[model samples]
Target: MSDLLANLPGRHLEAWHYTDLKALKSFAFAAPAPAAIDSALLPDLAMNRIVFVNGFLDEALSVLPAWARLSSHEATKSDLPLAILNAQHRQAGIAIDIPDDVDAGAILLISISQAGAPIALFPRHRISLGRNAKLTLIDIAQGEGVYWHNPVSEISLADAAQLSHYRLQDEAEAAFHTATIFADIAASAAYESFSLVLGGQLSRAEFHARLGGAGADIHLNAAQLLAGTQHADFTSVVSHDAPHCASRQTVKSVLAGHSRGVFQGRIEVARAAQKTDGYQMNQALLLSPHAEIDSKPELEIFADDVKCSHGATIGALDPEQIFYLRSRGIPEPEARAMLIRAFIDEALAPVTHDQARALLERAIEGAWSKLVS
Candidate 1:
């Protein structure tokens, strides 16, 4: 840690601490550039909405349904980590709410601008789903140059509520991003999340979910494609505290060029969580000698009669599979790409949007071509 970082308390740390201090000091520090929004960035989606551009709330572009509420607050007032960064800088993000008993859909749009400056920005969001309410959230992040973006999202679920969240990150070479999402689940509530990391210099998304009531259910799945010198990390922690609760997670990544990838997952079943069912799996593909991947999956069960399992695999393209395709007259590069695609298809199976999955597959195929050629 630099003297600047050591002197700055985590809460009182300066904006430079929000990102790599060395990078910011070595380079000319520039204020974050504004992210421009395209007209109709989101078509008439069924859900209520909150929009943030360049980490700042854009009320004019947000659509607050009659059943929903949204606002931006000083970080010190909330449990979120924003205060740790905000105490030293301005609040660059916003908060969101969905009242109980409201049959509404909600989406929060987060975007980055095309400005050619390395920068750092923070965003904070909070959501609550009332009894029996249903919500769908779509979050997107993109940028132009090398920059750092750190975001935190917190959610609370009431009895019988359901939440579906989708996240996409597609940034340029100079971009680095880290995001953390925390959720509290009520009895019989459900939380399903799907995330995609397609581009960035360094990107990591952390998810923590806890069952606060009996019989809660949670499902999380993520896929990442790393090319060039880009890197990505997907970390998750799931805890089952109530009896009969269930949780499952599957994460996958493809590493090419000199890129690196990481996946760390943990599932914990408390003593009271009897009859819990927890499962986790992580798999990776390395397409080049210089590409690297690391995975760690763990299960801690204190309850008797609970079923839990965790597994991880890291490997390169299977030569036998590649030969089979090459023997069919396909070029070596194409054959290898096909095999790797098949290996990763299972990770994308849960994606609800066909178009999004297709776009991701196309991106993966393009990455393979670049790596092999």
Candidate 2:
């Protein structure tokens, strides 16, 4: 009943400057309908899992853990344009609530979108951690055909809670995907997150994390590997409204063909957050002359005693290094891949979950196999 384009963000806005939505206006997206996919296509990760197909829950394929449940969507309080769009068509999402002092091992949230007429899907998911609770969440997005997958996740961490969040975005070559995450962390809570962007025609992932209590902290790290004409964007805004809080971000992008990558990160420290420690870095490696990358890192501080910094770098692979590897009898394609793996090693360090780490690394390997040689 509502007009979807009424509030769609475009290049005119600074947030969407590098990424545009004008192409979306051309499609008449029908509501998401049921679609089937082969189980073989799913990743071989070992974890309690839930599956969503075309925005609808596939109960038959889901294996929920004790800490997760099928529940009504939690209304989001986000005013971001992407969140607002997701809220409009949100159907169902799983809610994971870990009580105090519990360690819920690992949970996998898999989204599979099959090919069909142009459609749009919005899935709203929630995660909550009680005092001192711990959890590892692996979120994988993979799909086929032309469509838009817009999802929103709301996270809450009580005092002293620790959460390791790993996300992999591997949408279809013709699909458009946008994911918005809102995290509220309490005193002494830590949210460690890493996202790997490998697919999607035009995609963007945005994070809004707020340190609401003293001593809270966050680590946001991501890597984007793209080829062809693909476009991907990683945007994050971290706010420190409480004292003694800290935030760190390191994002890397590897571009080939004419693909483009964008990273926008901002850390805001309030006057009362005197002990805040914030740092951000964005780096990119260009494999083609036509490839492009945009990096924007910012720090806004009102606290006189806070330590905050931000920086960015964009460059191509070192020709001398490639020549040296060749002199050592290494092939060009393999050498390039080796350097890329080394470039992203720091970004992957925060991924402590062995299985999830392997899965993400494998995906990158697969991408490069097709891209190089």
Candidate 3:
């Protein structure tokens, strides 16, 4: 795997890069295995499952479903330090292929049982949805001790195909995680992503999406809850390369204690992307005097005939909304929670699956309860 370290960009720790190389130089590659597996909490999932315990792939706990194809190799293909993580550490990973016109579901569960000082783990994944195929993916990342998880995932959508991605990161208090994801949407294709980040000392998720064909549509929504000194960043760049494409993005963050959150979104409509429509917004709620949030929403349009707009709001909870709920015999804490939940309801409301939506709603409420209680 030393070939992966060939002539490439220098590793730099920037706000945009999200990983510190000095902190990732410790762990020596060992075979992957989970210390324990919680069978009850995990249900039977349709998509292939890849489990990584202690920064290595755990073959025993992973299942490659019949409808998918898997392969593993040590090579650098992406353009960032974090994107080609498995190549750098000689760690094992899986590549998934969904056959044409096939409909299925899969989940990848990655956990770190013991992360020692200066240890970093990278989990690399690739997914391809064939023409008219559909798929749903769930990703969960957890780490123990003071560690770093630099993960990268790429997805390509064929004509009329649809992909839905759901990700949850609940690492240990001392762990730091950064993820980069790229999606290419084809004609009449659709892509949707929903993310929840509740646990991490510092976490960042970056997304790059392109509408490569006409009639493409993409929807991106994320909710982040940070407490204490934790920090979370969500950044996305969406480009419309074809005419008649549409995209929408909305992000909501709740910060308490001394935690900080950042949201950056950019939407571009190219000269060829006439008749394109895109919208983006970022909103935050500060639960403590020390909490802080930074939001940047922007739009660049080269097409003379297009509609695009962006909005951002960073403030505390509404007094009137809290009072209205409190006047209805609700307790002060409960009223505040209710108002905060309402602020996030717009993103959760569009989710069609009851179970998935319920899970996210519960996680959001749990974070609020922890902050207020």
Best by TM-score: 2
Off by over 4 Å in 3: 1-48, 73-76, 84-87, 106-113, 116-118
Best-to-worst order by TM-score is 2, 3, 1
Candidate 3 per-residue lDDT, tens place, 21-82, comes to 33333434233344555554443454467766765566677786765434455454766555
RMSD of each: 4.6, 1.3, 3.7
Quick one: best lDDT, which candidate?
2
Each candidate: what lDDT?
Answer: 0.71, 0.89, 0.74
Clashing residue pairs, backbone N/CA/C < 3 A, model 3: 47-105, 47-106
lDDT of 1 by residue, 1-373 (tens): 1222232224244322223323334444345655667746543445446666666556677776664444565443434343355334444454545667776655656565455655666666677788888777777787676666767777889998988777878766677677778888999999888887887777778788998788899888887878787778787889999988888888878888888888878898899999998988888888878988878777888889898988888888888888888888999978876776777677665556544455455556656655566
Q: What is the TM-score of each candidate against the true structure?
A: 0.83, 0.97, 0.86
Give the TM-score comparing model 1 with the true structure, all chains together. Answer: 0.83
Q: Write the per-residue lDDT of candidate 2 for residues 1-373, one digit (tens) a residue.
A: 2387677997888999999887788787778888777788777777788888887777788788888887767576667888987787677888999999999988889999986787788888899999999999999998888888888899999999999999999999989999999999999999999999998999999999999999999999999999999999999999999999989999999998999999999899899999899989999998889999988888888889988888889888898999999899999999988898898888987899999989998888888875565
How much lDDT does candidate 2 score? 0.89
Query: Which stretches in model 1 have alpha-carbon errors above 4 Å?
Result: 1-49, 59-64, 67-70, 74-83, 86-94, 106-108, 327-334, 353-373
